[model samples]
Target: MALSVLAEENILLNQQLATKEEAIRLAGQILVDNRYVEADYIEKMLEREAMTSTFMGNLVAIPHGTDDAKKDVKESGISIIQVPDGVDFGDGNIVKLIIGIAGKGGGHLDILSNIAITVSDIENVENIVAATSAKSILSFFERVN
Candidate 1:
């Protein structure tokens, strides 16, 4: 059976994250808490970030485990954290949305593509950022599926 990639419990809204790492950890923790990934996957996420910034344009960042971290994935899952105040990702990039994902069997690519398409429209990003509840934020991702 396929696990739910994005769940309501995995969506956090109006987070006041202080740093990029904090934001990533918060997202990762949500994944872990939801049993989507093992705790070790969070470290892999950090390692991936060290290799390259996950920050996409239009105030978004998608943090995921590295190729080697695939073993840590229990199932395909995703976590969304909304930092309405914005967090600095480096080089003047401010991210208002942080997406954490753990895909089973190369499923990450599909999830990434869906998110890229959904958030490509700046309006959607704004709507997601301004979402007052986790359910509202989840609706955005649900539509992409």
Candidate 2:
């Protein structure tokens, strides 16, 4: 089975987004491009963002759709975009990594859990941001996450 977190095609490194919305939009695009979810999934994510910021501590944000968005998912998948420069996530929060997820059959919880645990360590997040290549980041996830 394909791993839901940071799949080879889903991981984007050293990207820059002008705003949280652009980052979220790009994340949704990654999901759709990978055939993990439908295009409408982007709308669902935007709506969810309007309700609350997904920004987690350690400069991470896990943007996901509301429960209703589940139906739009064709497969459980995740996208990781590294913006080392960081984007403002409101309330003076700037997120360096944006993890956008589209989960089917409740598999997203596992994906999210792994990320939450991994990023809980400040050094881990820093190392990931500084990773020179996508392979290195994936290797790190395989080893520690």
Candidate 3:
């Protein structure tokens, strides 16, 4: 599933993130509210992130998990959040985008790999951040795929 497909217009927005913890919590709530994952799933993912940095280089962060909370999802989903103020990811860099994913069916590697490809392309990330509408982001993914 395409990331933008699961990203609803209301879910995608510009936020003023003051801290990394807050960002993760807010994003996690969005996931649960959307029925993408369980309520506690985001907290667990944060614990996992604490073990290792999700901040991939260039102002991007992909927080993901492949646990039971996401075991029933038929398709992957992505929530794009832009923090104008940026959040510290314990790496001295402020995060501009938070791409959260819940991989169902135990295909965590495949989901992460796909995201890696997308985020690796600086141009694509740039396009996504530049997008003002969810449909525009979806269209961007279409072009990339």
Candidate 4:
């Protein structure tokens, strides 16, 4: 399966955000504006983030949610955003890469795991962060697969 089924290359972009809140807001807005999810969905994800930091370290934040708003997706989707200045994810470290995942009805674990593996690779992660366009990031998946 292609990640493109869930994420659109056009939706991914480089962000110049100054704070963690702004990064999350921008990511959430991307989903809403593209009809990938409802507006409240972002808030709920942020609430989840408050309960526990989603910062997995190495300047990465994976914010995810399993809700009714995402039940119709058919497959999970991931949107990648690069914040140039980095944002504070309440983890004492700045976050430069934001990965947002929204599952379908259920059974999105596989997709999530795959993404985790991909990003966990130092080389792969570096390539993605250094990518100049969404096309470059999308191509990384091809090599991984």
Q: In model 1, what lDDT does residue 101 have? A: 90
> How far out, in Å, is residue 100 in model 1?
0.4
Candidates in order have lDDT scores of: 0.88, 0.87, 0.69, 0.69
After the best TM-score superposition of candidate 2, give how far the Cα of residue 34 lies from its true spot, in angstroms: 0.4
- Rank the models by lDDT, top first: 1, 2, 4, 3
- TM-score, every prediction: 0.94, 0.95, 0.82, 0.84
Candidate 1 on 1-145: residue-level lDDT in tens? 2225777898888889899999999999999999989999999999999999999999999999999999999998989888989999999999998999999997887887888888898899999999888877666667755
Q: Highest lDDT, which number?
A: 1
RMSD score of candidate 1 (Å): 2.2
Clashes of 4: 0
lDDT of 4 by residue, 1-145 (tens): 4565445553466677777666777776666666666778778677767677778877788876535446534345666797756788874778878887776655457667767788787677677778887777777776685
- lDDT by residue for model 2 (51-111), tens: 9889888999999998899889998888889998999999989999888988788788888
Angstrom error at residue 25, model 2: 0.2
Ranking by TM-score: 2, 1, 4, 3
Candidate 3 stretches with Cα past 4 Å from truth are 1-5, 66-75
In candidate 4, position 88 carries an lDDT of 84
Could you report the Cα RMSD, in angstroms, for every candidate shown? Answer: 2.2, 1.7, 2.6, 2.5
Q: What is the lDDT, from 0 to 100, of the residue 19 in candidate 3?
A: 78
Kindly provide the TM-score of model 4 when superposed on the true structure, using C-alpha atoms.
0.84
Looking at candidate 2, the ten consecutive residues that score lowest on lDDT are: 1-10
